[model samples]
Target: MRELRGPIGVAIALWAVVATLFHLYTAGFGFYEPRSQRSLHLLFLLPLAFVLYPAGASSPKDRPSVLDWGLAALAVAANYYSYAQAFRINLRFENVTPLLWPEIVFGVVATLLVLEALRRAVTPVLAGLLALGILYLFATEYMPGMLNYRDMSFSEIVETMYLLNGMGMYGSITGISATMVAIFIAFGAFVTGSGTGRLFHNLGTRIAGRQSGGPGKVSVISSALFGTISGSSTANVFTTGSFTIPAMMRAGFRPHFAGGVETSSSVGGQIMPPVMGAGAFVMAEITNTPYSSIIVAALLGSLLYFFMILVSVHLEAKRLGLVGCDPSEIPPWREVLKDIHLLAPIFLLLVLLMMGRSPHFAAFWSIVAVLVVSWISPRTRLTPRKLWDVLVQAGNNMVIVALACAGASMLVACLTVTGVVISVSTLVATLADGSILIAGILLMATTLILGMGVPTTAAYIIGASIGAPILIQMGVPVLSAHLFVFYFAILADATPPVSVASYAAASIARSDPMRTGLAAFRLALAGFVVGYSYLYTPALTLQGPVLEIVGQVLVNVLGLVIIAAGLFGYLRSPLPMPLRMLLVPVGLFLTLFEAYSVWLRIPVELAVLAGLAYWPTLLSTPAPVRGETTRRAESAPD
Candidate 1:
């Protein structure tokens, strides 16, 4: 339980800084070949992961034991062993490379290190899952039908997993971390360190604190703005929810509702772009879609998601008869703008991305931009010491993602080796029994399940590898299919039963965990429809003509409104239970953009409009809870 001190803490800090410098150097100056680049990246991260993350939950919190340091050194050395002989390994194109004893020993060590890292950083289930995959690799032929596989020798399995172009540990994902994701994450760290988070929080409070459901709306806005920068959902929650959740409670929201809003909105940051969660970078690489295209395709869905929360908050505010925070209590916009220059780096990054710069390039210069812009204000200035701490924090943040990506790449390699990737897809297709909707549901369920325990990048990487192929087989567009799985994976954090994010927010709000989770799920219902909408009609993903995209968006926007109103039982006034039930199907139908459904939508739209005109008469008089106030202060303050 002793805190890390003296040489060991300094060593760890230096190692992380060295790693950041390595990535910064490669990102700006020149790059290594893919294998070397990624191998070195993994080597840099392996030791840091061991030393930074505890070996177990019961392991030391502040200090590393001798054994822990030794293991950390070993993990780094193993990667260096592969990296040092990259040229010699590359020459052997086939799997017939002779395994020296060191190679064999290190191979086994590398496999164990990856599993241990996964066990430490992610869940034990994922680590066990990788162990099972490796077991399958060596003993597949001994299985029953449908679970059977072609057996490969132990050496062959080792070759494929550890030594084959470093595909297992140093694959596309590792490559992404080395080149693209690390830089963007570093940019995030710099932005946060330079005071952008405070600026955004101030702006959000000033902009949203007095609106309907003021504090909740402030949370939605701040989390969205902040999430766009950090791109990690849980981090987003803890960062902004610490403020927003408390504010919502004071604004009269139930503890559970406040918690649910924070969890749901923070989770939305993963789906937001141009600097989305790390998963977006991997998704762009895996799907062969340009990062810009991915961001463009995601724009509508992300905005609609925020819009849904906004509408729901407004309705709840109306139902509760809540009022905005007193102007005397709220921060003024002018005061918040004092740190406005802190936003230049963010705007620059977004502009460069829109201009089609590669993500790494945009991120590299944005980091510089943050450094440069921080000089403008004495209050936001970054000293060398401060900047060093930023890099260390960046490295610390990158560790979880590095471990997740490494493990994911290993699982990806395993599935590809055992041919299970194709089998799982075929099995999913079979489960669908030819209905694309059924196939979509099965894949959605799978991602959500994996997402319950896995980080977004790992869950999506695994799900897309298995499920996207099945969807493509069913004629779904490549982007739409990957987007579908990715969306559901992000949603998994808010989903009930095993949602870590909901639990995190529940703790903050002092609410029931399961109830918060359900509330989050209710608020996030639009996400499910939107995920499927892109697949049913590609226009939603920016795949079709401009007119088609606009028309489709308008229709779906209305559908989202109807869905939200129904779910919460309020629209201008409280909707009756029967009307609420009626709107669900109508809302769902409005999202199904196929020609056949258009016929149903037309009549449904007319009826909805007619209902709106006569809405006042539909309900019996003495409107329940009309002008109701959730809390009454008995006397005015002196």
Candidate 2:
């Protein structure tokens, strides 16, 4: 986060460019051995973390201190030790071979360095988790029954956490970060730098600016589009919410409501298809499912999430008598389409992915495609300077992801080595009393709590490590279980109390963080419903027949619409409080109604909901809005 202006800054910049090029080249061609590949990646990123992120509040802002340089050097040395010893490390059986003093020393340093880097670049919550995992490993033998395992010595723990290739700081999770995650992050950087971000905003305004709840809808559309590449919900909020939140306030929306809309919609982007959040890649790696298939299964559930957000916004706008942007202020469709070529890379990336190409391979070509398409218009072109900026951006972004993954690897190492993962899974299974729903509720709570502190990807990794096993043991499909964990992890960003995305939006909107967070949680409630829905019927994940998928999807959509109407107190017209209260549970019950064929349930549920919605109009005349927001908006136009 420092802004150095001298030779040290230039040196760091050069290192970042080289780091990005390394990943791009490896992605396009082939990777090195797993140990070599992952360790080398840490070598490139770990040093940057120390230099870029200050160690503490008193740390220098303009340049790294001597201690920073020393730490960076240590990171490089420790990772180089791994790179050099990778062959021997690979050949040696984990926990079976005795470690030399030097290996033990370097392993300890590497593990500590990863934890420190993660603390600097990410949340200390995750770092604390990793530290506790290490302590738990040391205290294993003293723990109670079912929580007990053979205690590991310092040297043995070092071997597991660092020297080993597949279960620690240099594990499969880190491998995911170094390879597929890094390449996609680089692709995102290029896409962002290529003027496509501007295109997304413009396209959003063009398409949604004149609709009901136009400004909020614009936030939903732009954030979701940007989320595909950006992946981070808080990043998406800062990127798109800066524009849309102010627009909503100008259009007479309450500050908290505006922030809530942006927060919920931005978080929904992680569940969006194609280039989903980094957690999706981790899910693929952990579940051993194809990335394409995961996205495919996630498609409907993600749509329902956005649909609820959109519907809620619409109903809220209607209830407030909110008006869209003036037609003159909206862009013409043709003008917005002029930069449509910017999307070619994403389309091509999708094509290659559907063709069964490796994710890194697809992302590598997609980066190339971004370069090719960038030259189409002078306004969007990436010159050498811009190219360097792209690389710098990518390297900087990868720091958090790479370190988070390495830290997560360390935690997973402890859990596995201590046999805590299975114990926790068994405990949840027993507590659930063989009920999948109860087991899911337990996992969802854990993921949401964990996600509130760490990045969603790391949360998913940890949640899946603990929760997915329980669901799978209960006979849930592998993909369904992982998706369930993934959804809650993402939704945590919009959940109240500790919602990061909502807080980010609140900063922009100058709203109460708690109020904005509650609003966001309310708007995004459908995501939770979708997660639970898939637990019962994998068809919601597109696992069943086409007709079944369509019918169930229709049913879910209708139910969500009803829920939105009830929550917002509007359906065709504002409902009386009693009707609003009645509609919510009625809607929920209908959503859970799945005994008969979905084909048969759809029309009946539709008729019943329609009767409830219109019944309010028949009971009494609707009241008119006379609020200050409406009066102020009419008196002083934007």
Candidate 3:
């Protein structure tokens, strides 16, 4: 495989920087401009598309061939032309007669480009969905039942695909990407540049490395912290798991358990606060809520998730009787403090956001902070070359996100044009027959299934459009509905059958992916219950009176502990099978409904207290090991 020459690498880097700057400019500045200028934001991705082929490749086979480059260039050009034409026309046509042939041509090329880009950047499943949606667009007239749509000529279809009326590449996905999504991504990149990643890892090690399941706890804490800045679950797993997975294995965790721990914890990052997955941005757009509110809700979920992970690690440590690292090996406080300056960027970002600044402004200034902070310590200072590299890497990362956004934008566009969202929502509402819980369940199932292969942003947009309204109609709060779907969408990454994060972790641990996925599912049981709790108890969402919210939080925390203990099957010691079985359903009932009959609640509470009290006794008992039992039998027989 031939490596990229210095000049080529530099060129690719410049292209990415240019594209990102264009996106930032259009997103942050174009809001006051005419609609046409706003639409021009689509062109920002063109240079990014050009650079991505070279940037993503790492080998001769991976490198973009001449033909690949040509195709990419054509796609970008077509996308630009389509956006330009749509902006000029501005809904002037009532029918398809006034649409231009160039629009149709662009649509075809853009569709092809989106598919190829998905194949290169994401997984095959996403690519297939894009193809399927485009196919549906072309063959809508022949479909039967609820999927059927009005027949349109090829030109009409192209016109619809290229238009800017809340559908097409210029609609919700790209619109949000242009605004909040880009800013947060930039914020994350800048924080990373300022060395927040290292700080998180070091802090995680210091806080958790003295425990029995120290490494696993470290993975959970570090991954959750990393998720605050790096919203991508796959990236989170590789970054923290590379260190923690091996450590866990060395500390005596089974390969599958280690992999499952990392996978589940890494997947939690998407639901973390501040810079959650792109899905949160889309949710804000669709629901018309402040971005900060979504961040708050996600923060709540993340806290619960990380707490559960910590409990799991602690219990497992107790079960295994493992020891902590030697004190001599621990890093000194003074050394850890030396890099504390790196945290300035993140602190500034949070403060700016809390102060009501736009995410774009917050991100831009935070980048400046990162650059300045990096120079404060000579050891961590970014050379001019490294600064340029950070800019370039930021751009490269944005391209993968941009292309996925564009493809998802196309899918969303189709849903709008065909009125599929309304249709699907109507069908789901009818199925629920006015029950909010049933409607939410149906929506949850749908999002989970769709999200298995689709990116979270796309899944959230699709689910929110189709599922959220049903919940609202059934009396569920709008924020709760959208957040519920978003939570389930992220959980799909740790879900069975097609759990991408689990598969990645399994590869690293050399374990069975299915088993690892199931383990992750078990560990994440509390999250699933929390999803239902949002519907049952709005207080968990910070919506009720202050006192009520506090009380609800207390109950919810207790419920989480009960569920965790039940799932682990040990408190201070191994729980009896009957007791474990009983606690599971009791925990779910208390958590999900928040309404426990006094009879059931009192008995269950007492039983849990008794179990806790008996924990020490259980652990102290000398249960015979399998090997010990075998030796005693052999000696007796002789």
**What are the TM-scores, per candidate, against the unseen true structure?**
0.94, 0.95, 0.90
Best-to-worst TM-score order: 2, 1, 3
Candidate 2 has an lDDT of 0.89
lDDT of each: 0.84, 0.89, 0.74
Clashing pairs in 3: 168-413
- After superposing candidate 3 on the true structure, give the runs of residues whose Cα lies further than 4 Å from its correct spot: 1-5, 24-59, 82-87, 94-97, 597-609, 615-638
Off by over 4 Å in 2: 621-638
User: Taking the tens digit of each residue's C-alpha lDDT, what string does model 3 give over 17-127?
Assistant: 775666556545555233343345445554445434543344244345576568757865875575556546665753544666666677677666667767766656777
Cα lDDT, model 1, residue 523: 86
Give the per-residue lDDT of model 1 (tens digit) for 42-101. 888877767777876688888886777888888888888888877877787657657777
Q: What's the CA error at residue 316 for candidate 1, in Å?
A: 1.5
Evaluated at residue 7, the lDDT of candidate 1 is 85
Question: Better model by lDDT, 2 or 3?
Answer: 2
Candidate 2 lDDT tens digits, 530-568 = 998877788988887888888888988998888888889
Model 2, residue 631: displacement in angstroms? 40
